[model samples]
Each structure stands twice: as structure tokens, then as C-alpha cells.
Target: MFSDLDEQLASTLRHRAGGDIDPTPIVTRARARGRRLALRRRGLIAGGVAAACVALTSVVLAIPGIRGTDDRVVPATALLLPQAQSGAPVRPGEVGADPATVHFSTDPLVSDAEYATWRSGRGIESVEFRGPSGGSRFALARTEVLLNELQQTLSSAGRPQPRSDVRVGDRPGVAWFDRSGDRQLWFVRWQPAAGLWAQLDTYATSRDEAAGTASRVRFDGAHRCVVPFRLGSLPPGGRLLECSVTFGRSAPGSFIEGALVVGDDSGRWLTVRAQVAPNGSEARRGDLVAGPYRARRQGSDVLEMVVMPCVVEAFRKGWGDGYTEAEGLAILGGYQPAADLDRPDTW
Candidate 1:
């Protein structure tokens, strides 16, 4: 029943897919080189995609998550550093506004330098303490929480929906969203074993009008901190899981059709083609599974490393560094690490 619909949808996407295909060979070769470069880099690092940052921030803020406190929250500078020689609390909000002053804890699980670099690029303006509900206390920027709130809202509105289990670098996560609409967005959150707070957001605005408006707000937003990740810390033999929903523009450009891809680091890949039936049912048409593909790493340092060529390519194409880790892991699907790889199971 769905085969006919699948073929129709595939035919509709043929042009876009074909254009996308033309770059595959070149991308494959570049990805091979990128992988080797990433391995040589030897530490998990984040990249900087200037354009994507703007889009991501806008989408995150627009969603319904948390509206950060404007005046009540205390900045990171106000908090006493664990090893500070002086007992005095630094003036609140002062240090946070200066990229140079914001520092990630020097714990082995966290990279101060990487955090600093991310803060410098993002221009973080303030840090706020959220909760100590029980024994857990989180120190996230007011903006970060705000973005999370936006994502939650979008998720609640059913604009962007969760699809499957996946990994961002070595961290486990889930993927969601529909493309081809005015607002196309996806997100993944990686909770590290080291007990640090971090998250990744990937969003796209295909409509020119929405893109223009979102771009303005995103660029003008106050918070600009980049979340940091430790890719090299992943267990050498760890596996990656990836699931994606691809959207295609409908005839006359009225709507988008989507498909699903589920793959794992164990070298298994599955593609489930889907379409919205006239009755509003999500019709699954065809399925394809293949695998045992090799994975690649890129970059010379943690500050520049790129894992997962496909994701890197997307970032380079304009997705931004923030999404690179998640995109790479998604591209790799099931990426099994070598025996030498070792990542801790618990934070």
C-alpha cells in the first residue's frame, strides 16, 4: 500500500536528492581526509559554524522552555571558585560578560580551555544557578535555560517531534523534527558520565521569511556561549546510534514529506521511508538496512576536531560547530570504536 506513495515521494525528491548526490563523491573523499585529520587531533573538540549559530539561537529562544530571569539570577562570577585564595565573591555578572573570565572547572572530565574558547566565541553575558533540587545543583547560563524552554515548547506544540535513539560523539541522545516546513528543527542532549551540564540544538528555517526574522533575533540575542564536549574521552570500543527524519518539499510547495533512518555504531544502518497519507496516517513505505562502514575522525586538536564526516560537511556547509558533534554521530549511525578506546561508564 505504501510502496506507491514511497515511489511518488522519492520521485518528488529526486531533483533535490540528485543535487545532493552530485556532492557525495567529493564529500566522501573529503570526509576520508577529515577522518584522518580528526584522529590526529586526538581529543574531542568543537568547531565554530558562524551562520548556524544564529539560526540555532533564534529557534531555541522562540520555543517555550524557560524564560531566564532578567534581574534575579546570579552570574558565575559571583560564585566563589573552589580554589580561590580569597574568600570574597567576585562581583556577579561582571566576569560572565567577559569571555576571558568565564572558565570551565579544571576537572579532568571538563576542558577549561575548550570552555573558554566556546564562551569567547558565543559571548556569554550571564550565568545563572537554576536548582539544587535535592543534591543536584546546575549552573547554566540564563540563556541556555531559555533555549531549553523554547525546545520544550516546540516539542509540546508537536512542531518538532522525537524520532529515535542516537549519540552525539560518544554521548547518547535522541533525534527529532521535520524538515521542509517553515520551521525545521532537531535537538539532542548528551548527559556525560562526568556530571557536567551540556546540550546541543540543531534547527533550520527553510522559508525565506521565517529565516530572515529568526536570523535577526538569533544574531541579536544576548547569550552566545557554545556548549563544550569531550569526544576523545569516549570509550574506544563505544558504538553510535543515529536516526534521522528527512523532509521533501511537496508539489506546489505546500508541505514536506519525511523519511526515517536508524543506524548504530555496530555497523548496522536502516532507512525507513515515510509519507503522510491522505488520512493523516504516517505511512511507512520501504526499508533498507546495510552496513559495517568505517568511521572517520577529523581535526588536529580538541578545539578543532571533527568526527563524522557527514556532520562535519553539514557544519562546513553552514550548520555551525555546535551541531557538528551530534551531526557526525548521526552520520556514523552505528560507529564501533576500536579496542583501545576507553570511556567511563559513570560520571
Candidate 2:
């Protein structure tokens, strides 16, 4: 789900799409995804009807606390775990939070390092503390689909010390140097927990230094993977599935990349992807969310706009004729973080 898409699809939360992005493949596959999902949704509906028939014959007792799916007013943290709520401890298995809602904080490189620079991401779950002066440059992520592929970026150098096993603190780790670029990029991978893995792209010139940096990655804190924008309501029959944010490299607050997914009862998905624009002017692309144009992408109606440093969109995929342009705009208009696009700390 992570890519240089450096793109923000939920999966796009890893990296924002670049100039070289070829949308042909993704657009092609996405074109058929809706039909496949429609078939699956029908099956689910059929099953529900049978269950409903059974319930009709039973003497139902009143359940005082039963709740409906909609109108549950809660903060965006509705997607987060109790651990992220107030720095409280959660017993193992006590929480089953969505991967999109999970974010982790790492210990500082220096004892006196500030934690504010650590931004949320990797589905916007794992957090990495960025050093301004550049000391502790490490990242930790919860294990998911992207871990192995990311670690495998290193091509087989087939040269001196291509790959080696190392220890991160007490955990077993792998260290490798990617010689694909003009400079060598050191990488290390290890498990912070059973379902969680951590990665470190080290500047260290030696294997020992690389391992040392990775070993420093301690999953010390948790937070909601907060996106720069928010949704006041959801698409009809849709619920939030995931939301991810990516910060700029040169300046953490200078740019923001993000994605949010809302899935409906029909098994269709609505995605809102946001990223900074290449041009300095927002009007270069038009403020789409302001009065979003109902354009189409990959066979579905899409609402896209340019809000200055941010280019935002909400589009449909995976089954059914879903949200109309009006519906999509409601989701997009509710979030107006243009004032804080460069304020990562506020995120």
C-alpha cells in the first residue's frame, strides 16, 4: 500500500505522487474494481436478507444501548485507540484499532531532542521523529503490506558486504546498502513487535553505525495518525476506512500529502487525496474544493481542486454509482486546512 505514489491513495499516504508517475496502470485496474466490488456487495446483501428473515420470527428483546451506524458524534479520534487517547496504557488485545488510526512515536536521537518534529504516517500510523540539526534520523512503522517491499529497494550490489544480519538492541535485524544511486544509502529493518516492523534509512558509512541507529528506534508513544483536514460527515452509506498524511522532506511543515478512504454498504470506496502543488499559485489548478468540478478519473466521477499549496480530491472507486459531485464536495468542503497547510505541528 506504500509507494513513491510517493502517491496518496491510503496506500498513497506513504509518498506523494511525483512528476514521473504513470497513472495508466492504476487507472486501468481501478476501472474494473468497481464492477468486482458490486458483485461482492450483492452477495453480502443476499446473505443479510436471509438473516433478516430469521430475525422476523424471533421475540426480540429491547437492548438499551444498541446504536445505529450513523450520527455517532465523536472527534476524529473515533478512529484512534485508547493508548493514543491520553497516553494511557492499553492491555494486550484490549484494543483493535484500525491500522489507519494507529501512529507511533520514537525516542529522540539525543536525550534533549524535542518530540514535536515526529510526524504521523505509514497509513499515518507509525511516527518518525525528524531532527532539524540532523542527529537521530530513524523511522519506525507498524508492520503491514509494504514492509518487505520497502526493505527490498536495495538491489543486489553483488559487491563488498552486500547484505549482513545485525542486531537491533535485542531484536534481530538486517542491514544493507543500496548502491543504486550516486551515493550509498544504508537501510535496516527489524520487528518492534509481532505485527509491527521498523525501517531506518541511515546516513552511516558503516554497517555498525546503521545498526546502531536502528537499535535506537523504540516505540515509546502512540497518537492518532492525524490528517491536516477533517470531514464533518461521510458519504451516503459510507464510513471512514483509512486516512494518511505525508509531510515534506526539506521542511516538515512546508508541504503535506494525505489520503482518506470512505467505504459504502455497496462495497464501493470514496477516496480523498491531497498534496501540495508544484506551482506557487493555487489558481494554477483552481480551488476545486471551493466548488469542485465533477470530473472523471478511471471511470468514476471525481471532485478535484487546488487550494493553494494543496491540491485536494475525492473520487469514487470499487462498485456502484455512488457519491454525486455534491456529495463528494460535502466531504471535501468540510475540511479547509489551507491556513495550516504549512503547519505540521497543528496536524
lDDT of each: 0.26, 0.45
Q: Deviation in angstroms for 59 in model 2?
A: 58
Best by TM-score: 2
Model 1 lDDT per residue over 190-275, tens place: 33333222333334332232222222211111322221112232224332121111111111111111112233345433332211
Residue 250 lDDT, candidate 1, scale 0-100:
11
Scored against the true structure, residue 25 in model 2 reaches a CA lDDT of 30
Question: lDDT by residue for model 2 over 1-347, one digit each (tens)?
Answer: 11212224423522354423334234323322332243236446654211100001111222222111122221211112223544443222312235334434343233322212223322323333223332233444444355543322222242424568989888887887755335455777777666666677644667788788677654554455555666666756767766555422121122235666766667666778765443332444433333333222322355566554455667654211466666776776665553453333345
TM-score result, candidate 2:
0.51
Model 1 lDDT, residue 300, Cα? 16
Best lDDT goes to which candidate?
2
TM-scores of the models, in the order given: 0.20, 0.51
- What C-alpha lDDT does candidate 2 achieve relative to the native structure? 0.45
